[model samples]
Target: MDSAVITDTKTSMKAIFSDFKQLTKVGLSLSVVFSSVAGYLLAIDVINYFTLFLLALGGFFMVGASNAFNQIIEKDTDAIMKRTQNRPLPTSRMSVKIALTIAILFTVSGIAILYSINPKTALFGAISIFLYTSVYTPLKSVTPLAVFVGAIPGAIPFMLGWVAATNQFGIEAGFLFMIQFFWQFPHFWAIGWLQYEEYKKAGFNMLPMNTKDKGAVKQIIFYTVIMILVSIVPVLKLSGAFYIHPITAIIVALLGIYMLYFGVKLHRSEENKDARKLMLSSILYITLVPIIYVVDKFLH
Candidate 1:
C-alpha cells in the first residue's frame, strides 16, 4: 500500500479508539468495576480469580452499554452542555448506527458473562441498564426526583458482586446497596453544584430544588451525615454478615468525617471550590471505605 494511505489508516484507527473510550466512559466504568471487585472480595471466603475477572468485565461492559444509550438519548442535550459537548455522539465523531451496534454488543456480552456466574447477577445487570437508559436518562430533564430514581442503578454494582459471589440477596447485599445509595446523594449534589450552570444549559434538574440555594446545600449536608451514619452501622452489629472491625470502622468514620467537613464547608461558604472539594472527597470516601472493609474482613 501507499505510505500516505497507510498513515491515514493508522490515524483513523486512533480516532476510532478515542471515540470508543468516550462512548464507554472508561473511567467511570472502571470505578464501577472496582466496587464490584471489592464486593466480591468481601463476600467470598476463598477468592476465585476467574470469577472476579468475569465480574469486572461484565460490570464494565454493562455500565458502558448503559452510558452509551444515555449519550445516544441525550446527544442533543449533551451538545449543549460544556462538559459533554465533545462526547462522540454530541460531536458527530461517531454515528448513531455505529454507537447502537456497539451498545448492543456490550449489552449482550455483558449479560452473557454475568449469566455464566449466575442468572440473578445477569438479571440485575439487565435491570440496571433498563432503569438507567429508559428511566433515568429521560427523567433528567423532567424533574429533580430523577436523582432519586437514578440512585437505584447507580448503587447496583457493589451488591451485584455479592450476588455473583453467593447467588443470593440478603441483608448483607442490602447493606452494600444502602451505603452506595446514600453516598450518591452527596457525591452527585456536589457535581450538580459545581456544574450548575452547565447542567442548567442542558435543562437537567440534577440539584435538589433545581437551584444552588441554602436548601440544596442543607440537603447535601444532611445526606452526608446519613451516609456517615450508615457506613458505621456494620461495625455496630446492626447489619447481618456485614461487620467491620473496630479499627477499620474508626478509619472509615474518619474518612466519612473528612467528607462531612467538605459538605459543611460547601454549605457555609456556598462556593464552587468547596463543592468541588466535596466531590473529590466523596470519591475518596467511597473508594477507601470499601477497601478498608475488605481488608478488615480478610484479617478478621
Candidate 2:
C-alpha cells in the first residue's frame, strides 16, 4: 500500500476515535461510571470482580447512550451553543443515523450487561436512558423545571449500584439517590449561570430564573443547603446496611460547607468567577463525598 494512503488511514482512524469520544462524552460518562461503582463498593462487603466489571461497563454504556441521544436530540441547539458546537453531531462529523445507531446499540448492550447481574439493575438502566432521552431532553426547551426532571435520571447512577448488588431498591438506595438528586441542582445551575450567554444562543432554560441574578443564586444556595443536609443523612443510618462512619460524615459535612462557602461568595459578589468557583467546589464535593463514604467504610 502507498505510504500516503497508510498515513491517511491512520488519520481517519484517529478522527473516528476522537469523534466517538466526544459523542459519548467519555470524560463525563466515566465520572458517572465511577459514581455507580462507588455505590456498588459501598453496598457489597465482599469483592466480586466480575460483577464490578459488569457494573462499570454497563454504567458507561448507559451514560454513553444518554449522551448520544441528547446530542442527536439537540443537535441544532447544541450547535448554536459554544460549549457544544464542536461535538460530532453538531459539527456534522457524524451523521444523525449513525449516531442513532450507536445510541441504540449502547442502550441494548448496556441493559443486557446489567441484566446479567440482575433484572432490577437492567430495569434501572433502561429507566435512566428513557428518562434522559425521552423526557429530560424534550423538557429542556420548555421550562426550567427541566432541571428538576433531569435530576431524577442524574441521581440514579449512585443508587443503581445498590440495586445491582442486592437487587433491592430500599431506603439505602433511596438515600443515595437523594444525595445526588439535590446535588444536581447546584452543580447544574452553576454551569447554567456560567454559560448563560452561550445558553442564550440555544433553546434551553436550565437555570431556575434563566438569568445569573439574585433569584438564581438564591435557588442555587437553597439546593446547596439541601444537598449538604442530605449528605449528612447517612449518619442517621437511615438504611440498616449503608450508614457512613460519623467521622466520615463530619468530613462530608465540612466538604459541603466548603462548597457552600463558594456558593455564598457567588451570592455576595454575584460574579461569574464566583459561579465558576462554586461549580468547581460542587464537583470537588461530589467527588470526595463518595470516596469518603467508601473509604470510611473500609478503614473503620
Candidate 3:
C-alpha cells in the first residue's frame, strides 16, 4: 500500500479500537472479570491454568458484549444523561450499526470460548447477555425496578466462573450468585440516590420515585444486613471446600461491619454526599469480598 493508504489504515484501526474500548466499558467490565476469576479459583478443586485463563477471557468478553449492547440500546437516553453523554455511541464516535455489529461479534465469540469449556457455561453466558441488553437496558427509563432486573444478569459472572470450573450449579454457585445479587441493591441504589437528578432528567425513575422519605436508604440498610449474613454462610459448614475458620470468619465479619457502618450512616444522613460515600463503600465491599473469599479459602 502507498504511504498515505498505510497512514489512513492505521488511523482507522485506532478509531475502531477506541470505540470498541468504550463499547466494553473496559474498566467496569474488567472489575467484573476479577470477581469471576476469584470465584473460579475459590471453587475449583483442581486448578487447570489453561482452563482458568480461558474462563476469565470468555467471561470478560461476554460481559463486555453485554455492556456494548446496553450502550447501543440506551444511546439516546445516554446522550441525555451527563454521566453517559460522552460515551462513544452518544457522542457519535461510533454509529449504532457499528456498535451492534461489534456487540453481536463479541457476544458470539465469548459464548464460543465458554462452550469450549462447558455447555452450561455457554448457556448461562448467553442468557446473561440477553437479559442485560434486551431486558435491563430498555427497562431503565420505564421504572425504578430496573435495578432489580439488572442485578440478575449482573450477578451471573461470579457464579459463571464457578459453573465453568465445576460444570455444575449447586449451593456453591448459588451462594456466589446470591451475594452479588443482594449486594447490587445497596451498590446501585446509593448510585441512584446520588444521581437521582441526572437519572430523573433522563426519564429514569430510580430510588423509589414517589417516596423521598428514607425508603431507599432503609432498603439499602436492609440489603446490607442481608449481605453481611450471607457472607458468613460458608463458615458453618465443615467441608473445607467453602468453610472459613474462626479467624477468617472474624475477618469477613469485620469487613461486613465496615460496610454496614457506611450503609447505616448513609441511611441516617440521607445526604447526596453520604450516598456517594456509601456507593464507594459498596464498591469497596464487593471488590474486597472476592479477595476475602480467596484468602479465607487458603487460610482454613
Candidate 4:
C-alpha cells in the first residue's frame, strides 16, 4: 500500500471514531451505566464481577442507542441549537443511514446482553429505548409535560440494575426508581433554567411551566423537597432490603440538606448562578446517595 493512502485511511478512521463518540454522547451514557452499577451493587449479596461487567456493558449500549436515536431524530433541531449544533448528525460528520444502523445494532446487542442476565432486565432495557426515542424525543416540542414523560425512561437504569441483580421488581427497585424519578425534576429544571434560551432555539419546552417564572422555580423547590424526603426513605425500615444504618441515615440527611440549601437558594434568588449551583449539587447528591446506600448495606 502507498504511504499516502495509509495516512489518509488512518485519518479517516480517527474522524469516524470521533464522530462515533459524539453519536454515543459517551459522557451521558456512562453516567447512566454508573447508576445501573450502583443499583446492582446495592442489590447483590455476593459480588459477581462478571455479572457487573455485563450489566455495565448492556446499560451503556442501551443508553448510547437511545441517545443516538435522539440525535438522529433531532438532527435538524440540533443543528439550530448552539449546544448541539456540532454533534455528528447536525454537523454532517455522520450520515443518518449510518447513525440509524449504529443505533439498531446497539439496541439489538444491548438487549441480547441484558437478556443473558435475565428477561426482565432485557425488557426494561428495550422499554427505556422505546420511550426515550419514540415518546420523549418527539414530545419535547409538544408539551412541558415531556419532562415528566421523559423522566420515566431517565429513571429506569437505576432500577434496571436492581432488576438485573435480583431478577425481581419489588419495593426496593421501586424505591430506587422513585428517588431517581424525583431527582430528575430539579436536575433537569436547573439545566432548563440555565439553557433556557438554547432550548428555546431548538423549540424544546423542558421546564415545568415552559418558562423560568416563579412558578417553575417553585416547582423546583417542591420537587427538591420531595427528592430529599424520598432519598432518606430507605433508612426508615419501611421495606425489607432497603434500610440504612442510623449513621448512614444522618449522613444522607446532611447531604440532602446540602442539596436542599441550593434548591432553596435557587428559589429565593431565581438567578442562573443559583440554578447552576443547584444543578451541580443535584449531581453530587445523586452520586453520593447510592454510594452511601451500598456502603451502609455492606457495613450493616
Candidate 5:
C-alpha cells in the first residue's frame, strides 16, 4: 500500500469515528445505559450476562438514534448555538444522507435487540424514540413544555431495565420511573439556567419561565425538593419488594441535600456558578443513588 493511500485511509477513519461519536452523543448515551443496567440489577436476583449485554447495546442504540434524529431535526438551530455549532451536521462533517442512514440503522437494530429481551422492553424503547424525536425535538423551539415532554422518554430507561428483567410492570418499576422522572426537572432546569442565553438565541425554549430570573430559580428549587422527596420514598414502603435499607436512605438523602444546597445557593445568589454546581451535583446524585439501590439490595 502506498503511504499517501494509508494516510488518506487513516484520515477517513478518524472522520468516521468522530462523526459516530458526535452523532451518538456517546457519553450521554452511556450514562443512560448505565441507568438501565442499574435498574436491571436491582430487579433481578441473578445476573444473565447475555441479557445484560443486550440491554446495554439496545439501550445505547435507542439513545443514539434519538440523538441523531434530534441533531438532524435541529441542525439549523444547532448550527446557530455556540454549544452545538461544531457538531457533525452543523460543520458539514457529516452529510444528512449519512446521518439519516445511521439513525434508521440504529433504530432498527435497537428495537430488534430489545425485542429479543422482551416485548415490553421493545415497546417502551420505541416509545422513547418516538417521543424524543417526534415530540420533544420539535417542541424545543415551540414551548418550554418540551422539557416535560423530553422527560417522558428520559424517565423510561431506569424503569426499562426493570421491565426487561421481570417482563412485568409493577409498583417497583413505577417507583424507579418516578424517581428518574422527578430528577430530570432539576437536572435539565439547571442546564436551562446555564444555557439560557444560548438556547434563547437558538430559538429553543428551555427555561420554564422563559427567563433566567426568580421564576426559573424558584421552579428549580421546587422541583429539587420534589426530587429529593421522591428519592426517599422507597424507605417509606414497609411492605414492598423494592424498599431500600434505612442506611442507604440516609446516604441518598445526604446526596440530595448536597444537590439541594446548590439549588438554594443558585436561588439566593442567582449565580451561574452555583447553577453549574447544581448541575454537577445532580449528575452525582443520579449516578450514586442507583448504585446505592443495588448495594442496599444486596446487603439487605
Candidate 6:
C-alpha cells in the first residue's frame, strides 16, 4: 500500500506539471527566451554568463506571467475553441484562483529580478505584462487591431533584454524592436488567416470579419517589404556594436523578398493551406533573420 501510494503521488505530480505547461504556454515562452537572448547578445560587448542566466530566468517568468494571465482572461473563450478546449483553466483542471496567484507571483518575481538589472528593464517588463494582460487579452475579442497592440508587448522582450545589457535605450535597441515589431504583421496575419474559423467560434476577431483575403494579403506583402527595408537600416551606418556588411544585408533582404513572394502568392491563390504555409514561412523567417543578423554582426 505504501508503494502504491508513492506511485500515485508521483503520477499526480506529473499531471500537475502538465497543467502548469498549459498555463505557461511553454512554446511561446521559449520564443520569448530566443528573442531575449538575441537582444542580450547583440547589446553586450562581452557576454556575462551570470547576467545571461538571470535574463533567461527572469524573462521566463515574465513570459509565464503574461501567458498565465492571458489564459485566465480567455478561459471562457478557450473552452469554446477546439484548439484551447483542453487547457488547464478551461478544463477545470486548475482553479482560476490558483492561476491568478501564480500569475501575480511570477510577474512580481520577474520584475524584481529585472529591477536588480536596471530600472528601464523592469519598467518595460511591467509594462509588457500590463499591456498583454489588461489590454491585448481582452482586445482580441473586440477588434482585429489587437494584433497591433499585442505586438508592442510581444516585441518588447528583445529590446528589454538589450536594455538590461546596455542600461540604455537608443537607436540600436530601437532597431532591434522594429525588426520584431514589423515581423509580427506577416506572422500574425498568417496565423489569423489560418485559424479564422476557430477564432470566430471563440468570438475572437483575429481576421477581418469580412472574409476578404485581398486586403489581408496586401498587408502581409507590404509589411514584408517594410521589414526588408528596415532590417537593412543598420547596415547603412556604423550604428553601434552591431555591424552587418552590405552583402549580408542584401542576402537577408532577398530572404525577406522570398517570404513576401509567398505572401503575395498566397493572396492570389486564396487557399487555406497556402495561407498556413505562409504562416509557417513567416515563423521561419523571423527565427532565422535574427540569427543572420547576429552572424553578420560577428563576421563583419
Q: In candidate 4, which residue ranges exceed 4 Å CA deviation? A: 1-8
- Per-residue C-alpha lDDT of model 4 across residues 1-300, encoded as one tens digit per residue: 999999999999999998998899888999899999999998988989998999999999999999999999999999998888988998898999999999999999999999999999999999999999999999999999999988999999999999999999999999899999999998999999999999998889989879888799889888888887887877778866978888887888888788789888887888999999989998998888888888888988
Scanning candidate 6 in windows of ten residues, the lowest lDDT window is: 204-213
Q: What are the lDDT scores of the predictions, listed in order?
A: 0.93, 0.91, 0.84, 0.91, 0.93, 0.86
- lDDT of predicted model 2: 0.91
- Kindly provide the TM-score of model 6 when superposed on the true structure, using C-alpha atoms: 0.95
In terms of TM-score, how similar is model 5 to the real structure? 0.98
Q: What's the lDDT of the predicted structure labeled candidate 4?
A: 0.91
RMSD of each: 1.0, 1.0, 2.3, 1.4, 1.0, 1.5
| lDDT for residue 268 in candidate 1, whole number 0-100 | 89
Residue-by-residue lDDT tens digits, candidate 3, 1-300: 699999999999998788788889888888988988888988876789898888888888898899888888888889998899988999998988988888888899999999999999999899999999888888888888888899999999898888888899888888888889999988888888878888888888777653444877888888888988887887888333566667766777787788778778877877888887788878888888899888777665
Predicted candidate 5 versus true structure: per-residue lDDT over 219-280, tens digit per residue: 88888888878888889884257888788889999999998899889989988999999999
Q: Which ten residues in a row have the lowest lDDT in candidate 1?
A: 240-249
* Candidate 6 wrong stretches, greater than 4 Å: 208-212, 238-241
Q: Candidate 5, which ten residues in sequence have the lowest lDDT sum? A: 238-247
Report lDDT (Cα) of residue 143, candidate 4.
93
List clashing residue pairs in candidate 3. none
Residue 11 C-alpha lDDT in model 4: 100
Clashing pairs in 2: none
What TM-score fits each model? 0.98, 0.98, 0.93, 0.96, 0.98, 0.95
Q: Pick the winner on lDDT between candidates 1 and 6.
A: 1
